[model samples]
Structure formats: C-alpha cells, structure tokens
Target: MNFKGILLFISLGSSFILSFFLYRQWSLTNWFDALFLIGLLLIMVYCVMVLIEGQFFTAFLKSTRNFFAKVNKKDQLIRESEKRSVEPLDYRKEFPNRSSFLQVGLFFCIGSLLISSALHYLN
Candidate 1:
C-alpha cells in the first residue's frame, strides 16, 4: 500500500468506529449528516496526502493545462514530425493510485454502515 492508501485505511477505520457510535445514539436520525461528515473527513485526508506526496497535485495542474491547450480549437499548420508522432496514454500515470484509495474508502464506508445496522438490529 502507498502512503495514501495507508492514510485512507486509518481514517476509514476511525470513522467506522465513530459511525457505529452515531448510529447507535442517533438511530438513523442523523444518517445523512454522518455520511456528509465522513465524506468531508475523507476529502481532508486526501488533501493531506496530496500535500505530502505533491506529485498528484502537480500532475493534475499539468494535465488541466494540457487539456485546455488542446481544446483551444485553434487551427495551426501541422508539421510532418508532429503528424507522424503519437503520444501514448497511460491512465495510471495521470491518476497515481487514486482509484484504489476510492475503492478502499467506499468499501470501508459500506461495511461500516452494514455493521452498524446489524448491531442496531441485534440490540
């Protein structure tokens, strides 16, 4: 696991515990609020990870600039060399393991909700 993945797991694990408590105390009265709070926490964790790694943020800015440059719709004479050359697309390079972090976080959130529901029923 990368640094981001580790951070995600830690945050999600703690959130799961907190969520369980909220579910027990509030009994679904604040389910949406809890979900929103957890989403914000996850976003904050991602922002911290981005700050620590730094590469993803820089790549995001670079890719945005490239996208705008390509989308300008300006007509220019194509050079022979540029016509012959093709840029390779590797999504992994652009995203930098973001999918895994999302997947793990999503799974943890769902699992926590289920567990909380089960506990509520069992009580």
Candidate 2:
C-alpha cells in the first residue's frame, strides 16, 4: 500500500485502540460513551498518523528541494540533471506542473477535515 493508505489504516486502527482503553476506564457498559470516545479519538488519530507518516512529507519536501535547488542557476541545472534520476530541472521547462508541497498538503488537509467532520456529524 501507498504511504497515504498505510497512514489511513494506522489512523483508524490507533483511534480504535485508544477508544478501547478509554472504554475500559470510563464507561465500559455505556454504548454512547464508548462511541463518543471513538469520535473524539479522530483528532488524536490524525495527529499520530501525521507524526508517523511525516517521513513521506519529508520525502516530498526533498523532491521539492531537488526541484528548487536548480532555480535561477540554470548553469548548474544541466549538471544537476545529469546526476539525478528525476531530471527536476527539465520538468519545469517541459511539463511545468508547478504545484508546491504546502499547497498540495493544505488541499489534502482541508479535504480530510471536511470529510471527517461530516462523518462525525453523521455518526
């Protein structure tokens, strides 16, 4: 599975585990309390998933660094392109798919938050 898929699985799994622990301590018998705990765990799960999968974000960043490491220095671009597999310097000239890492992540987070909030309200 991809990192995002792994992250999603980890997030859901950890939330359930935490909910289990809270269930035992606070209200083992009450279904509603258990459910509420589960719902609350979503925030924690997001936090943990972000922590663990931060490396993926780092990887994306490293890619961007590779991309920008050539910016304004076309002199070195040709040389750097020779050393790397991705040819980041050529990409800006050819494809120009210039989406920044932060913009992509902000989009993802906004989407995820919306979906999670909707699910919370529905549940």
Candidate 3:
C-alpha cells in the first residue's frame, strides 16, 4: 500500500522472476552468470530497501558513536558494576515495528535458489 510495501512487492516479484529466468539460463548455459546475477539483484534490492527506509545510515552512525563512547569509557577502567550500568542499544527504538514479511520472502527466495543450485550440482 505504502512506498515500502511497494518496494518490497517489487523486490519479491523480481526475485521470483529472476530466479525462474536464471534457472532457465543455467540449464542452457552456465551457472556462474546466474549466480552473479542473483547476487547483483539481492544487492540492488537491499540497497533500495535500506535507502528507502533511511535507517541503515542512521543506525550505522548511532552504533559507531556508541562504540566509540563505550571504548572511551572502558579506557577509564570503570568498575564492572558501573560497566553494567551503561544502557544497551535499543534496536526497537531505532526501527520500531519493522515488517518481517520482506525478510521472510527474501530468505525464502535465497533458500530456494541455494537448494536448487545444490541439487543441480549433485545431479
């Protein structure tokens, strides 16, 4: 319905379509091309999803800053009890209510691709 949902739908559809075409091509030609194209498609979909959501960059920056702050604090040799006092990063706060459907679809596509490839190789 929304932009993210639309992108997810496009990505999932492309994954299925590409997998079908890649399998056909692999049967006729080579496996390397199919594998490369699969990887490329996955990367493209990932980039589009991440950029559209605009959270990856924000999460990365936040994690980096948190890491440095922890490192600096550790250098001060704080007590173990004090170390435990530092609050952990709350991923839920960063990206609340993230959809799992896209992840499930992506993983399903990847799993099918790998299983098919393995079967082909075994044969």
lDDT of 1 by residue, 7-62 (tens): 66676555556667777654442553465466555655556666656554666766
Q: How many clashes does each candidate structure show, in the order listed?
A: 0, 0, 0
Highest TM-score against the true fold, candidate: 1
lDDT of 3: 0.54
Measure candidate 1: CA RMSD: 9.1
Top of the candidates by lDDT: 1
- Give per-model TM-scores: 0.36, 0.26, 0.29
Global lDDT of model 1: 0.57
The Cα error of candidate 1 at residue 30, in Å, is 12
Better of 1 and 2 by lDDT: 1
List per-prediction Cα lDDT, in the order shown: 0.57, 0.48, 0.54
Runs in model 2 lying further than 4 Å from the true structure: 25-123
Task: Give the lowest summed-lDDT range of ten residues in model 2.
Answer: 90-99
**Order of candidates by lDDT, top first?**
1, 3, 2
Q: What is the per-residue lDDT of model 2 for residues 54-123, given as tens digits with 9 covering 90 to 100?
A: 4445556667877676564874666677865444322211212222223333444555456656767887
* Candidate 3 least-lDDT 10 residues: 92-101
Runs with alpha carbons beyond 4 Å of true place in candidate 1: 1-5, 12-93
Q: Candidate 3 regions off by >4 Å?
A: 1-43, 51-105
